[model samples]
Target: MKNLLIAFLFNFLCLCVQGATLDFAFQLGEKQEPRLDKLLPDVARQMAFSRDSKKLIAKGMGGTVVKWDLQSRQKREISRIHAKRWFVYSIGANQLLVRDADDNITILSLGSGDETLLTNGQYESGSLSAEGTLAVLSKGDNEVEVWQLAKQGPKAVKTLQTSFPVRNGLTLSDNGQFIAAAEGTYGDGEGHRTAIEVWNTINEHPIKVFNTGEILGVWNVLFSPDATMLAVDTQKNAQSGIRIWEVETGRQLLMKSGFEAYWTRALAFSPTSDSLASGGEGGNLRIWDISEGESVIWETYPTGIQSLAFSPNGEYLAAALWDTTIQILHWGTSHER
Candidate 1:
């Protein structure tokens, strides 16, 4: 009976290992390729698809923000607010948000071409919810505020503070309910520890924190479209690993590797939440199937990707390269892996 039980246990362990190592199946379509690249004016600082994925908001040279209609292929100049550098993103279909060099946040309306200043406080990095109703902004004081953007100006609904100052920016959920904040450094340097905190932005409370326990500083943190999973990456390209965590349970789902390259800090989740893409340092752009665990690489640019965005429909990907050009790749068609 002892020998029989040992055999059964061995078989069970083998099955578990097999299941864990299983690779996802991939199907890429033949003759389907990236459609074309669109070059834009000045240096592109930031690019983001409008909440509905219908339009794209970009901060071109001179701190000028432009909203491009994806379907019409036309450009509408939104704002040309001047500053040395700033953080700009689309608030929704009608408004655009720009945090200037002084850390002042301004809301721009595309239809009327009007600007509204948000005098909440001095903010460091920020993220907007999909609905444009909520915003999470990190301040220089190690405090994070969850703001209600849909109502009055920037009204602070919740505040989150960290023991350490933030290294990277913040990522908010679709409904503006959750926020992911990363703080720490990277590399083999001494005292290098990175931690990601997932907070309930709506309830104004803390959730789970992921302590990488490595000498790596996280560069980006993104939430899936459904907000069920979160992806974190560091500055170590070759040594960097994709840390995915379950939102509800606060449990890590998986760690994907082999993406190490030089300066791979830029990352964006597809609109479908089934894929991810990142670019930096090098002119190489890679697309990964989150579920299938495969990647399609593109090296069409002479420089690295400065910023990236997916169409609201997930049918296209727009990459602003360091070479001062924008490439809009046609996504959707699949091929055999």
Candidate 2:
């Protein structure tokens, strides 16, 4: 069985390499582009665009967050922190969330220029729900906390306690109803065994626990827009793959070989929940048909993808890569692929 799986993976990878081709619409931060270079340095930690895909938000290595407009090409330093290790965790349409070296969560409003200190607790990873109403943060040692965002102040809604020390890779459902977290250890014996746990945000209870066995470690987990499916990336002996699970039935629908050099870093579902896009490690972008349970289409670029976002109309797919460039791919072209 293992040999067959290996052979299948090898053949799939070859096909992916041959089929992969990137048709770039535009590049965000190229040399001689003063607008992008002047806003911040190229070594930014994270870059995200607003929900409308009209503006771009990038976190500088020096603890600064800048917002740039795509139409006017204007840039503004939205917020900055003095902490050496501070990094922007997530950026929303109206607000931006940043985490300091000390694990402090700060919320900043783009319109009013107001900032709110959400949490003082230390966390290894953090993410905002799709609706921007809730924030999930990992505190290490099998503990995670959820904060409710409000106009007045942010409140701690619940704490998710796990069985063992958990590493990063946290994802929240689109409707803000569920959270899927990767639970495992790091270093030496790392990647040995990782489990994915889905929890209900309202009651703060574990809805389902999917054990990935002893060979693979969970790299990323994503919940479908309708909260119907959970996509998980698992790594085994340096090879990585993805599995899709039906939330309601608790059935694993698909397990397909993914990028071999790097585990899947980002997984995003389309607005209609009919397709999914994932990118990681080898600068490979894969679009999968949920109904087919296989990767029918894939694309590869020059740089490794760090993050991905689908437009509200689901017409454009924006990918943030390691080369400090954002590539916007038309959804129509992908559908035709």
Candidate 3:
């Protein structure tokens, strides 16, 4: 009877290990290959999805913007704007934040083509909220400037002072109440350390700090739609590790490795905030079950992925590839093992 009981315990442990290593499958519904490199004179530099996920917009190097209807798979050129060092960071509420040749920031209205000046001078780095209502700009200092964007104009509302040097990849909450930024430094010595700081704009205080030990750098930082979770992709030991945390309690919930560090630039949470989609070097696409802490690697592409977005209904996922094309993937029939 003692030997039998020991054998049962060993079997149970093996079952648990198998369950954790199981791979969930994702159905590839359709790959919308725009072939932007052949169609346009210049390649598409960035892409964004509409709020409802019915449409997608791609911005090219020559200031040409094209909108595609996901249902029909048809596309048309929408607008054109000239800029020397241009970037389409955010698009929502019919507005896009861009930088002009003179290094000045402006908000361009998508409908009327009217431009509103945001900052007269150039900023070292900045991030615009997905809702297009809030923006955070850094000037290579310990402080970051927050602006409230509106149809009438842009107003400087608050300045977030950090305890450490502010790195790139600033993320602002959609509600304009909180901002998350990567702080600290990277080096070969023991003195090097990195941490992500979350600040409260309303009360002008720092709320939470997540320490990332011995990572070379952090590429991206994102807050969930409900502001309950924060996810970041960092480089550690020449590989990439994605970490997710509970915002309120400052608890690290999950950490996983196996992605290339240099190209892991995309991370998006599902609408229900139960799953997260990550894509990066080697065109590896994965969806992580947040609650279970298990992941499903759907596919690998020839090139790396630049960005990822989940539809509002959480039915489809959009992956913007480095080769200037996009893929639309649907959830498989069965996600549970």
Candidate 4:
């Protein structure tokens, strides 16, 4: 059975080749099979798997939140807050960081139904560290503030300023040692110039600046789990794609194109950091080899994909689809046979 699964994965990787075939295989072990978790009546737009990978938390379009038990295959509504827009960052062991429609950010306790307000005013965007220990908030002033979500309250650590206005993307490294934001501006005659800035949280100094010239916009920015690479989803006049950069040297590692920005904004790096997965509006999902920039692509659904996440143990890839469903695919990595 194991060998058959491995062979199936090998054929999956060899289904298409552009530059060169990847030398690795993403396997599906005998333990878990790829399955689709349906979200009926509620349409999920934001999602995050529990750190332990035992549960999945989803927020619907109308502000309904549900927690699904992976083992039992059951779901329960946790909390519901009506808002025009919402954000779900990280799901901790007992708490979740979320933002309501009015831009009120809070840490909600799953056990007691209690809420701890991190901030009350309006902010451009926010992100939480993987462990939920740190949070970063970006405001209109092009200043990104690092906050320590202490047990008592939230404390401002340091602020990192960007070169241009923060148009959209903002993310923090899991270790909370670094923060990244997308900076760009539209000029009268110079056109649109965009750049991604990474800052050291300790000294509030910019460590690396990736200048993406004349792009329409940068929609999302993410740091790899190991904090060694950064990925940005960019849209240009003629094409759109994702760009990856080496964190230490400020070097662009890869630029993968051919997908429309409107549909392919969701990106997630594998736990091993050797590959990446992206989902698109056309329900297309592509898993790309980081080094070679080749991918195994497939159409996941008929509707668009809104978000993507990987389990910490590298066992499952969860994608939130526009058709009101969360699809979880069992994934494992093994060396070339």
Indicate which candidate wins on TM-score: 4
Higher-ranked by TM-score: 2 or 4:
4
Ranking by lDDT: 4, 3, 2, 1
Alpha-carbon runs more than 4 Å astray in model 4: 1-41, 82-86, 91-94, 260-263
Count: clashes, candidate 3: 0
Q: Please, what is the whole-model Cα lDDT of each candidate in the order they appear?
A: 0.63, 0.66, 0.67, 0.71
> lDDT tens digits, residues 136-177, model 1?
777645678767775556676667777567776677887666
Model 2: per-residue lDDT, tens digit, 157-243? 778887666674677775778887888754575546677788888765688887777645665677776889988776666766788
Show where candidate 2 strays beyond 4 Å: 1-23, 31-47, 60-64, 73-75, 82-93, 186-191, 333-337
Residue-by-residue lDDT tens digits, candidate 4, 62-140: 6777788877667888877543355645645366666677777777877789888887766777778766788888765
Candidate 3's residue-wise lDDT over 1-337, tens digit each?
Answer: 5534542343233212322221221312233453424433233445567776677666655556666688777777764555433344454565666665677787776667777888866665676776788888876568889998876778998788887777645777655567888887755567557788898777677899888877766767888877889999877666777899998899887898767645476788877677777877656666787877877434556556767776665556777665555666654324333
The clash count for each model shown is: 13, 0, 0, 2
Can you tell me which runs of candidate 1 are displaced by over 4 Å? 1-41, 51-54, 69-76, 83-93, 120-122, 185-189, 237-241, 257-260, 296-300, 333-337
CA lDDT, candidate 1, residue 216: 57
How many steric clashes does model 1 contain?
13
Candidate 2: 10-residue stretch with minimal lDDT: 31-40
